[model samples]
Target: MTTFRASGPPPAADPAVVVVTDLIVFAKHLRLLDAARLRGVTPLFVFGPETAGRDLARHRADPDHPLSRVPDGDVVHVPDTSLETLLRGVAPWLRERRVRAVLNVGEVFVEAAGALAQSLGLPGPGTHAAQVCRNKLLQRLAAPALAPRWTVLGADRAGDAERFGAYPAVLKPASRMSSSGVRAVAGPADVVPLLPEYGPGELVLLEERITGREYSVESLVRDGVVLWAGITAKDTNEADTAFFTETGHTSPAPHLTPAQEALLLDANSAFLGAVRFGTGMSHTEFRLTGGDRVVLMEAAARPPGDAITRLWRLATGMDQDAALLDLALGTDPVTAPPRRRARQVYLDHPRGLLTDVRADDVPVHWVGERGRWPDLPPAAADAPSRGHAVLVSRSRGDLLGDQADSRGRSVSVVLDGPLGADLDAVARDAARAVTISAVPLTPAGRTGEAVR
Candidate 1:
């Protein structure tokens, strides 16, 4: 008997990273993508949702849109008029270029892009599987133990009073990402009537409300193997609890022992496998109460939004964007064991109109009015609204602390530690307080520098 070894040639393009961003320009994310491109991989950008969101028909450009600043050569921009259209447009390009893997960068663009690539016969997840993850109602249709309680109702009908949760239940938008319109409904008054009005254009997923701590698990897939992963506990701000504005988070599995971590990770892994996640990024958010009671909120086929990617990177010393880029490039990010402890990530939750900004009171570097920060707001104190100018903060405390500062009634920060809150009440208040209105400003101000 003889032992023989087969060898092939060296590798080609580093796994190609495909990110879907609603184009405006000057977005910090471009920097993240740029870093990956420099490290052997190519960065491709997918721009979607032509009219900001579903509600707005008027087109307003995001001054800080990542591409405005990033070099065009480094990115491949695929304009999105509609999800279906965007995919068909990009399919030929991906095929011609021979893309290795696709990184669904945002909630809005993930399923459509993944589906389109697969349909084009590209190596990626099929459209139906992406639908399972993107549609809240569909994701809830898991195995009995896996599926959440309650039913997936049409947004157009009246939610039956009897079928509603005995206690308060949560409502999910059909294709929502982030805390984008996640609501808590107590009984018929809240759940039933929503069907005729709120549920019409959208598919509503009604889930039994589970009282417990909220945590997010971030994981990356490589050649079908779950190579690197971590879990973080979500700590929210009490003062500006409305809108479920994310306030704080801690890494290395906060308050969760080895057993709890294992359970949640297992849940996430199962959820991913069930949905047929062959490649790309997967992030899951769940509620963990005592006695092994868990309610799965969602599992997305995209990078974790709201700066959590930065948190995972800070804690693990792994540039998530880079890793994602590597995944798309077909190269796995080599993890360097582990080191730092107690590292956390945070972002600010804003209220009212965001007019003027002064960071360290030094005239706010690289930020201006108009173009999203459009010329700041009229300097009128005492008459401020709620949930206006949301700024991103690094520390956990500072992000949530901005709520009490009357000087910043319109602004809020996201940080760590704790803000004791009645999450249910906060959710309702936020829904009533903020309806996702715009600040009527852009990133570019009177001056040349662009503001975020």
Candidate 2:
């Protein structure tokens, strides 16, 4: 899922870092270029469908591709489609290439691919670390002290719910990614119904929703040392806890004091160490209770999910994607962000087919290009229109309290003002302002597209 430019690394090590991906996308391909420049090492892009091994014929034909150009015959289009086959094919290659370490490029395959590759040869966090890193329960158990007071991990729904005593209990799939399957039960009635979906897990975190400020920190770690840290202040939307969408985040987290920040960093380091902080990058999310007490929520061994990498660069001038590649290839990372604060907002509309389009007056960054757009999907359905907006302002204070939303299906506007100004009614009135249209509902009763 990562790619880099042709720049090589320190001492110009040709370690043949392998990028294991099922499909090659453009942004990821560009990131590989960035990685090459930072790590000072050129890596091989290996695409594995798992039925075979490196397709040499394809490389021969397009010899200009980075994969084809790398050390000719180094083009490993590993033909294995399954994890086992991919690992088997990758093991000897690492050994043969004298690969010093194996760090999964990003928070992908939830470390499954990384685990398989590690098992065959080379050094990595291994299977256990991957599992713990991906599963919240195991992560919390691996470092109990770092997490807040937590208990109860089971699937009996009613019984478990009764046992745990009430609503607001957190439930998430053991292998679910993103916010795809995480739910928070606020009361008794919400418990029994979630069983069909959450009932299958051997364990789940029934966390006491600690009232506090939430933050996610990105850390660049190398050989047990946390090379650099960037903090993110989170803004979340909860429609009764079942759907929590992070609407936005501001980095260089303005709220944490020096002492609180230290505690967070120390706790994060401790958690990483306990979880075997191997190498590469990790994004750790935690809740700062009362703005001081830090509780570890989860640590993903990848760059912070979403396009926060750009936000980090704007806020601090650090290229995290490059940092990830640097440490992956055994080089020090560029972790410090340049002076300033920056923010990014993701429009998480209430799920339904994007019935209409509006907001003709808002600024947005589409793909790598910039310009004002119109009639875009409520959420972009494909490439050329990744749903996002980037507002880069040197004056961080000037951006605080700013809010952007699509006003119904016909109007899109961003209200920029103070950081915590009155946006409650603004958000509430959004549903009314935007013409909410109902497309023909599917037989499954789920929302479908209204393709304009």
Each model's C-alpha lDDT?
Answer: 0.51, 0.54
| Residue-wise C-alpha lDDT for candidate 2, range 1-452, written one tens digit per residue | 12222232334446556665533222333456546645555565555552123333453345443443456544455554456666666655554454544445444454665575455454445566666887887887899886765666554556766777534556655555556555667765776676666545456556666557778888877777887887887776554335555665666676577898888888888888888867667788888887567888777876675446655665555555566666765668766643544454544333343344333234332321111122121211121212123222111111112122111112222222223333334433332333322333345765533221
Model number with the top lDDT: 2
- TM-score for each model: 0.68, 0.68
lDDT of 1 by residue, 110-141 (tens): 66777655654444445666778777767777
Native-to-model Cα distance after best TM-score fit, residue 449 in candidate 2, in Å: 11
Worst 10 residues of 1 by lDDT: 1-10
Weakest 10 consecutive residues of candidate 2 by summed lDDT: 393-402
Q: Candidate 1's C-alpha lDDT? A: 0.51
lDDT of 2 at 375: 17
